[model samples]
Target: MTGERTASGLALEVLQQLWLGGVRDVVLCPGSRSAPFALALDSADRSGDLRLHVRVDERSAGFLALGLSTGSRRPVAVVTTSGTAVGNLLPAVMEAHHTGRRIVVVSADRPERLRGTGANQTTVQAGIFGTFARCHDVTAGVAVDGLSSLVAQACSGAGPTQLNVQLDGDLTPPDPDPLTWWHRPDNRATAQLRQAGDVGVQPSVSVPTDGEPLPLGPRTVVVAGDDAGPAARMLAEAAGWPLVAEPTSGARIGRQALRTGRLLLTTALRDEVERVVVIGHPTLSRPVTGLISDSALEVLSVRGRSGVATDPGRVARVLDVVPRVEAPEDPTWFRRWQAADERLSQLIDSGLAAAQGDSPRASGAPDLSPLAVAAVVGAAVGAHTTLVVGSSNPVRDLDVMATPWPALEHRFVVGNRGLAGIDGMVSTAVGIALGRPRAARTIAYLGDLTFLHDTNGLMVGPSEPRPDLTLVVLNDDGGAIFSTLEQGGRRYADAFERVFATPHGTDLAALCAAHHTAYERVDDLGRLAEALAESPSGARVLEVRVSRADRRAEAAWLRQLAEQAVPGDDPSR
Candidate 1:
């Protein structure tokens, strides 16, 4: 924060600035080049000024930072060695860029002199993230004059920023007492670091205005996608429109929220949709997309993210701030949607109960039906639970089959709907669980592929901090989602299994066994509930074997049922 600085001193000043600038969490990916940052960050953590998380995987480290920052609503930094390690952070940084969260990438680099000279662990990291990060470079032994304020400046834009710190072998603190710099005064506080709630020049999430309001008279439904937050719920309630909130939107609560939102879209209600007010990223179901693609109806989208960008809709309008709408005096139309929602909810519930046999299981496990497994999981994640859903079949199954309750009453739904890719999901949820209160449970519902895909995240070092996470895996042995799509039709059945289904017969329990984590193979619905209620600590895995064969027919039957629930227009005035 002061005049001149040493190689190690620059690293210390950088860390101090990050702490002073309101970054409470920092993730370090261990490597030889970033030794100084690791030591300085450890000292900061020891002093209780900040919390440090160490991850060997740079990709996991990036996502962990993304989760920590999102959970805390504060800027988070990820430090790594140069070259590929820095490159590994691109995914999370790209996500943060679109979602608009502050994730600082601190990479150790060779001096500018050594750059482009075929150095080990050295690549063009200066602009590695490109437009995604507001980048800065700090050479070895450079004066500490502006070093402290760089992090704040990077995060000031409301997205991710990269800092390439060059260092030499004397990686330990230049000064013996890490506390010595504490008393050393500087102008850091006065410097323009991003202050809490400070709006910046970047594409900031638009706040609502008191200008001319968007009329809410036309039939409208708010589609809350991942990270949509409570804004969608507020709009739905304020305007008397049905809320089609996704699990992670945090808007799936109260009476306005339709648990059968997607199904309703597939019915006559879709034809009556005059306008669709889309909020967040509503990419979970095709019905929502089909409704939005209706050129006859007006579509509007609100933007945000979790693991992926959430702007997946064709809208007539896009709002930074949710517009206040005037509710209609007569609520006949909305009532129809609600009425259909209730009827369909009951019918689906009954259908699932009918599908599952009433007989007791001698093995004491739960039913293997995907619906039963997801339902038990829905019941298991009671209040104070953070439910992180994986993409693809698992999330879709839960959306269609799981019982609907008040938002966060059972759990706060979370997912990576930004890019919607199934990368680093297990790690991201792990980060969320670690950041939350210990009393709360963090459970993840994902398909076998999603679970196995991120199995590397479970490869944590023994000394690393572990969270209380119960991973419920629905193992169908293949991609069941394909069965519900055009690919499952007879025309493509010959190539469907090999091409779209992509079955991988690896036993999930065996994978959990190798990782030394608890594994539960559930085949009974009652036993599934019991397993979740026990609240096991650390990481655990539950595998529910399901059949992909019936998925197509079952989905068709559900659509037919929803349609029948909507009665033909009875003009009994």
Candidate 2:
């Protein structure tokens, strides 16, 4: 393990440890202090052990790591220089810490001799992330052997870890394996304390006794958020509650109970339910929060981890019940919730019918509407498929247009809901696809710009096991949805288009060709359906060309429909 013991070699050793400890993706924001680290990362990436994403902005890089971690259920590493660059990661670190997501932050720091002497781009980084991280460690220089153990510990930890490496001068790569350490087994006891769990810590609450039965009625609704998983089904079946599963919950879209509505809103169950059982963490929607907060119902929040309750102050009861695996044995309560959900289903069908109002289908070139494209692709995908929706218009459109599918029972939705940025959309989607089962098809719905933003994510070599996936790019040329934002007014319209929209004239087919991916362009809905039916068993791009100008009119139509559907109480009006 002998060489010129250089700082870059130490950084490389740390990265190698993480890679061997099951970390596959690393996000790097370039800086001079971290040049050696970046070079080592590039070498590792070339060696095929890890995928490195380069982001210019430290803040965006943090969020990109957060998104990748959230999607893959694995710790993602973020690399940056010391000082303000390291500080830029606070927002994402805080969010991940609170949400029980795992991440590792590696910051390049100045040498000790320069500390407290006003060195350029230097700050107190040893314990700078004290509150936000689970553990913090600093290395004087690169230690190949010790870095492996630290990497293992950080990977296994439930929250973020900060590793500050102080570089001396020139850099060199470390030997792959240095020394091995073994631990003696020991039992230790510590004092137990209880508190309202916050981010980065597990809750200590005891589970409620399964003694007396909960009041069973036909008016209960279960609201599930992202990653609710099998628990959503188990809870609904146990309590006889109708499940209102969000797009991101990854639970079955339609099964025993009806699956309709956008995050518990379309059903409008707030008025009917006397009790609401919430599982998983909070959602990104404001309407869901308002409905839950304003409802005159008893809310029982159940979660496996502590500190997951979004509204601890308003919850009638918080149970530390492990969802699905430890759900109650009773079936009486579930029957009532199921009944209420069925009633809501009827209402939704009636509403859709009324909205249609015998209007003949618009005759034209039979071009695909964004809603039509999303619905068709969503329906055609396999039950065990992993659906990754990009930020901006793709996710929102999918949420609105995706129909209730019985085949999507084992499906999961991966999105950048934490910070909702479009920078790493494709890369995160690809990472998520890689984590799932080999048989499962991973379909990513992305906008044109989003597809271009992380185009490097598609650079999977022939030797790599790429996911059996489809990349559906809804290429409307620009940020079509921004036309509806508040800044879309005449006064700021041009500036909004230039700054926020930032449309790129991308040749998507040409981009896919360069990456050696199967590419198809379709404007006709029928052809689009046929393309999806073929189901190519490799990374393929299905580009649906839509008119950006027409999006404005379609949104207007949807607004009118919502107005008529709700009547008298139109928010847009």
Candidate 3:
């Protein structure tokens, strides 16, 4: 607890702790209050100990950290200056909290002496990211011991953590100290980690798996949501249950996946459901939401996180791990659902095929369909490829149209379903690409609005490290997703066109050119796949313009066709 150490020394120690705590990347937002951190991080970057990312906007830096941590599955640090700079990180912190990503937020602040004096660029920074992150406010009183302990605790596991460091005096590093990996008694790596007995904050909330395997009832099905991983797929296969997985869910690629699940939930089959098994965070569809929330359905979840991980209605049972539901009580349950899904899938295929027609486009330069575009993007995902899909209609499209192929061995499908607001998607994809293997290729599929929302993310400094990324922008002009909703109906068409479907006709090619990033307009599916095949060292934007007029007609027709797939209900079938 020495009182007279240089601020840089303290900053360097913090960085050391972060590095030892498994932080390989650091995102820095330049400002006066956080200058010590900036300098220390810069020095570390020069030494090649860590990769440093500099984003002028603090908000972008936070999300960049989030993406890096999520993609890397390791703690990533973000350093910001005082006042609003720290506050701006709330959105990303909240997202990390919900998504279970370990993003460490390090914010600099003025010392206690300047309290309530209205100092410039100084305000209450501590406890700013409340509830969303574990906040650590380090004063000079316990500066030595607390900082190290807090950093270790933050990096222990899931969820984001914030470190509010209020330093006094001029901030600059002392001469670079020898890298000793901190003061360890035996010079072993044990000092790098906290003791086994250290009872700090638990990384995430969990429910233990102690209950007996519940007896399977009739019409049982597995519902896999975002970040459900591969467990949901395995469970469905092992238990012989039909799996309805979202696009981001790793379970989406398997054979048991039902493409018409979301729409099916809206039909009569939803009424016949006797039991439900839920995994991951299911937030995409209203039918799934209603199913989980329904008191009539016997809902059970073996997912992590005690609260709202599955049953938002708070009635479904939550377990640490899924129970062994080998076979359903009703033998024909799986068969029924499978048959219906197969029939519906066939109908869907035929409808999309009819829409595509048997002719090649010459004047239209390739007709557009959102589902077709997403399918092409998903198909491009191969070995050493990471697919970062945006949270809009693009993700849902892939959920319906993506098939099991194109190097599925190491493929990754990602989306920001935690907040799902479509912010920082481009930057997040870049971070995801950089977080993966150096030779691995990362491609991002987002809407034009999402691309334009965080265009500043493309403003990377020339000297900074870049990601091998391909940004696929599905330009349907505006919010075509709203068109599929009730608002897109004839009654609200007038208002929907103006507000709900707010289309911004921004020239995406010109936008990429302005940023000095490579740009290309892809129409044909093969050309899109070809663009994805190339492993460029830096990021490039690939625009795919879709037709909104045809999109509306096609979606309506598909839904009409899906509604008829409920066997015995429609005589036309």
Candidate 4:
């Protein structure tokens, strides 16, 4: 493992150090310059040293790594060649940056001397990810001599990091092989790397259990955003406050959680809120963000791992941990919210049912509406089920239609809510399923456009490890999320179809066939339920065709229902 190392030898050492630093999964994108890394990673995977995922698209590979880290709660690596291949990782890296996932990006670059020499596939690789990820440059000399320290530095971050390795001539491994460097003698690097890994990022501390409890006198509410854990619901319960939890929030499963809270916030009830306890990243709803930004309300936020607490008003009281309640508040306050939430929930249900039509379809199945699709997908989640939701409309629809499960049903829900963009969602979902093998089931609720954005994610090698995933795509033929926004105003109606909707009539079945993945089209609720109930053989797409024409109307109708159901008075005061 020592003297006069070749580029391939350096690549093996880099991988060995990465493995020692607690990286168990690697996603490799194919390229000529990265042959050394690809070969080394393949050998490592074959020898059972680490899991390897191969994707032809670097962007997909990057997000796949992010998803793996998210699912496994450990560091995952994505390797790519030099040039724009490294640039393609920026989106996923940006996502991992805000979400606090450790996705290690290893870019194989031409030797340092190749820079400014008109070399092919040679451009600036270092610092390509900007502030999203810190880059560690490694040349053949630096790698052979101080590879351990470099890897330790790369693995120390709370979020994503990069290793731009400059490989020299003879990128492929020589005779005899160098992948056994981990099994070589005097592997003191392992112990050192483990110690370095121990020095890795620690979770942000919230208010301790013994910490001073927050006053229960105010008309408080817990706003649980994406990734907000059970603490938000527990706090709401302890304080006798309503929990307004987004779908991806782990806190959305309990009785205190209000299904119609988002809509309810738009009512007169918002004026009654005196204080807000915020948890996780809440980027889903305008009402929630508006509430947080309101200068009149006192905001208390539980700190997260991203080193930055979510404080829209810039005046939030940051808690070191989830604070306890001084005492339970009077039941009257809770009852008002409960009554309003229940009434609104009923109204929402009736509205959706009517929109979906009272009479069943010719097939005796319920109508195919976006909310209906989301409702079916949400209901499918059960014990040991991992639900990965896509951003835009699917998550928002799920937030509205999904019922709050009882506590401790073991439903793990997640999404790329850091930036909340529609990029690489398919790959992210696939990574989650592959990463958590023991889950009873894995289901992803995605929009048609979102599904199309990362079709390359379905391009798994036949020999590659495949996850049993059911990807339910709500195909409305366009970006239906915009229909609910101001841009969908009557004044913009003519321009809406061409610009905002951007509908592309893609044949999803044909697309799935191209990827060699199983496909199903569920036009009714009965069929959707049946599809979800079946055992997952491998990754499959359940395309549910919804209507964008009704999106605006349904949204308006729901808002009107909320306004009517919830009285506009501050009853608590």
Candidate 5:
């Protein structure tokens, strides 16, 4: 490949390295400057070497990549044109960076000589991502060796990376088999290959401690956010502390901890806990935020990545410990938390039982309440299966209504908790399924709007073995969760529905057909159970249609259940 030849071929060559390195999906935002990239990826797609996804909006594209990356564990790549197109990716990239998600952004740009000379769409592409990316490469000319090594580094690294390929206009696409630059016999490859082996362990010289454990206070609380995993349970057990966990944390509401509801928030803080040990990201509700602010206590934070400063200056102590794996114990503290956990479990049980007996009201023709759908989902799936909940109402409803499984089974729950967007729910679930083994089944519970938002995530190939996955789409037509908000009255209802809900008359069966996935329209509870019991292989879509009117009734019933379960005169209360 000569300098005069467009680096399109070299770019494709680098992309092939990424594909060979286990990248199954690539999101492309088309542009003239990025035509070469787009073309090469198109070729790869046709040959079945890589799966290409096209998104008009770069912001959505970036997030789609974020979701895919989070689900896949391995880095997923993104391609875009120069200037503002690259800038559009900032929000999702920042979120991915902070949350330690793996993603690679390959932006096409003009040559350096033309950068400052009033080029059409050019900016300081190099170093634009700052410390957010693990590595940034701005390459010009055709050098297979260098580009290949960089591609491997980007693919193998823990966080996101940028490869700004500056191209000359005369360059043309090369033959299909672009050179494998990464496979060259060089020191860089050797070192990177070695570094890949040490991916999970963060080098630590000393494990910091807050002197000695202070006497446990009555109001002391421990809150776990999304991605808290097993570490949250271990922490709560070790400290014997009551845990307030979000749905995405994989901690059951009545079993491992309490849900993040208004009442729980109030009670946890009513006694005025003097200290809080926040693990993972901060995902407390607004009321809890106020409580956290008003409490006269110190906050200690622990996370795998740095720069997540949600507690402001009150984060007296910070540690770089992996959220779910590390177990730091305090026997005395563990006893207090255990008692609190028991009290919360009893309250939740009573609440669920009361809700079950409430009169089932008449919902609309397509009567499918989001809460009801959630109940069906909770009951259908097995204890061992992973549940990847989408953002918006799906996660919130699950947090409140979902009960614990009978036995202790390793179940993982994931969401885009860092920025909490619905753009990549399907893709994230797909990636997560891909990460799991053949025996493991992953179920994705998402809303209708969220399902359509990133439907492209369903694309899978023969090489990318079909995951034992089930997709449960709660087709409520729009954002039903927002209806429960304070401004849900008649006056603002229409406007909210139009702008926020953005209802789409989507033919889910057709959508599944396009992706070659099995589609099952589940209207009754029995059908849902049968489908779950069989647990089919490959990607399957189960569309559970619920009427909007029924959703409202379900919400009302839930509130009543909460009220009756926790009598104002109860001693525990």
Candidate 6:
């Protein structure tokens, strides 16, 4: 090791120490102040010690890092220059905070003397993310041991961490003192701690230990929310209870899992649900919210590593883990849910198929409704594929349309359900796709608004690492989600079109052309499936033009179908 240090030497050591702490991916946005990190990361990438991803937009880089960390289940670092570039990371950092993603922000800053002195690209970078990320201020002259300790600490945290490094004098490395990736002993204990920390920090509370068994007398339903693991399904199956899992929920598989649980909850069965076992964070459906909110039902929420549990109703008994059932419930109870769910599922499928097959529109074109689009995308996912569902209508539609597979062996369905916001979804998918390079294919189903919001994610440098992702953009020309909500009522129809449905007629093909990305428009469901079937080679956009005009009417019709399938008055039909 050299006795005298330089900015590049410090940056290289930081990257080396971070790699040792289990960080395998780095997202770098080029900047003058952050040149040392850029060079250091390039060298690391060349040495094959880590994967480096470059993005011009810090916001996109942040989400890309978030996705990489999520997909890899390891700490990922996003490097940025000082000032607003660091602040641009707030959105992704906020999401990581709730989702428990290990995103390490390496924001390069001017020296302390330059800060608060109107220096170029310098500001109070420290503690910029506030509570969203734990911040560590690194000044010049910091020892290698201290830097390594900080890296270790940053790698093991509840959510995101920030290393605001201040560099002065020279930002570039001398030709003879090039930084290189060095070998280090495998610190298994630290690696394990980093992995364990991925679940997020646990809250300080006295609750039953993990794997505790609970009595099985009450009629319980397992509500598996986004990112909820298979434990939710296993618990439901063990207790012979119905599993109401969201589309992104890892438990959205197996026979016990209901395909139309959200809609089913709108039926008489909701009243009969004496107890609810919730896992992960549920943010998609209002019916599930109403069920858990009802004071009449007992909500036993499984505590997630995010240090918080889903207690939207504020009426919940938090548990350490998904409790085991002492004994299975009566076969009759499970059988009834199965029968009702089967009937409702059939109605939904038939209704969607019939609507797509025989449109009532004057144009005679098959109306590729959002729900129908979701169905095709969901069905197209093979065992080796990873489906990244966007928030809003697409995810909600998938929740209703996706059929529960008997087992989730190789396929994965995920979304940014932490904030449930539509921002950064495209870059998130790209990160996931890149991180999972071995996946047979990666597909992202997103609404038009969500896709447009992150179109900058499509701006990939020619030399930057690209993901083989097929982005299925359901272009309804507006925000269709609000149409199915209270805002879409007849009395509010006057304001609905202008405020709620804020349509933007952007030419998607031209937009993709600007990014130099492959673009194709699919109006038929059959062609959409065939397009998805083709092996993905590089980043491309498949735009499916759909109509939001009938969203409210279709929503009402679906609710009517659900009610007719299983009347609210009787549960034991």
Q: What C-alpha lDDT do the candidate models reach, one value each?
A: 0.75, 0.64, 0.76, 0.84, 0.65, 0.84
Q: After superposing candidate 4 on the true structure, give the runs of residues whose Cα lies further than 4 Å from its correct spot.
A: 1-4, 143-146, 176-212, 359-366, 569-573
Per-residue lDDT of model 5, residues 1-573, tens digit only: 435444774566667667645676787887878877777777677766666777777776787677666655667889998889998887677778777777789888888788788868878887678888865555555466666667777776656788877766644554545432122234664476557674422221113343334354444566666665555555565455667677676545334365434344544333545666666665636544654555366766665443464464453466455222134444444444344444554655555445444644455345344555666667655655677888777877776656554437656677777777776667667656655554356788998988898776676544444567898888878877677665555678668767765678789999899889999898766677677767677889999876564455555555554454444554543
| Per-model TM values vs. the true structure | 0.89, 0.70, 0.90, 0.93, 0.76, 0.93
**Candidate 2: residue 445 Cα off by (Å):** 1.1
| Residue-pair clashes per candidate | 11, 7, 0, 5, 15, 0
Per-residue lDDT tens digits for candidate 2, residues 4-52, read 4467656656665666556777888888898777877776677665778
Per-residue lDDT for 468-558 in model 6, tens only?
Answer: 9999999888998898888888899889888989999999999999999999999788999999998867999999987888888888888
Please write out the lDDT profile of model 3 over residues 1-573, one tens digit for every residue.
746455665666777777767787999999987888887777677778788999998778888887787677778999988888888888888888888788899998898779799888778788887788888887655565666678888887578888888778877644455332222223344453445433223322233334346665556778988877777776676667778888787677666777778878777777788788898888788878889888888888765431346678887877667566534454466666677777777887776677677644669654866787777787788766788989878887887677654224767788888878888887788788877765368889999888888898898998788887889999888888888778888899779878988878899888888999999998777788788888876889999987676556766676676678775474322
RMSD of each: 3.8, 7.9, 3.7, 2.8, 5.5, 3.6
| Candidate 1 local distance difference test against the native | 0.75
Tell me the lDDT of candidate 5: 0.65
Ranked by lDDT, the better of candidates 1 and 2 is: 1
Which window of 10 residues has the lowest lDDT sum in candidate 4? 199-208
lDDT of 4 by residue, 1-573 (tens): 345568887788888778766788899999999988888888788778788899889889988998888888778889998889999999999999998888889999998888999889888889888899888888777634477877766665678888898899897776655545333213576576556555433332233476458876888889998777888888888888989999888889877888888988888888889999888889988899999888788998877667667888787988767888767888887788788888988887777677567744565432577777788888899888999999999999999888888897787899999999999999999999988888998999999889999999999998888989999988888998898899988999899998989989899999999999999887778988988888779999998876787788888887888888776655554
What shift in Å separates residue 77 of candidate 6 from its native position after superposition?
A: 0.4
Error of 6 at 307 (Å): 1.6
Stretch of 10 with least lDDT, candidate 5? 199-208
Q: Give the Cα error of residue 288 in candidate 4, in Å.
A: 0.7
- Better-scoring candidate (TM-score), 4 or 5: 4
Q: What C-alpha lDDT does candidate 2 achieve relative to the native structure? A: 0.64
Candidate 1 Cα errors over 4 Å, as ranges: 1-4, 140-145, 174-212, 303-315, 326-329, 358-367, 407-411, 568-573
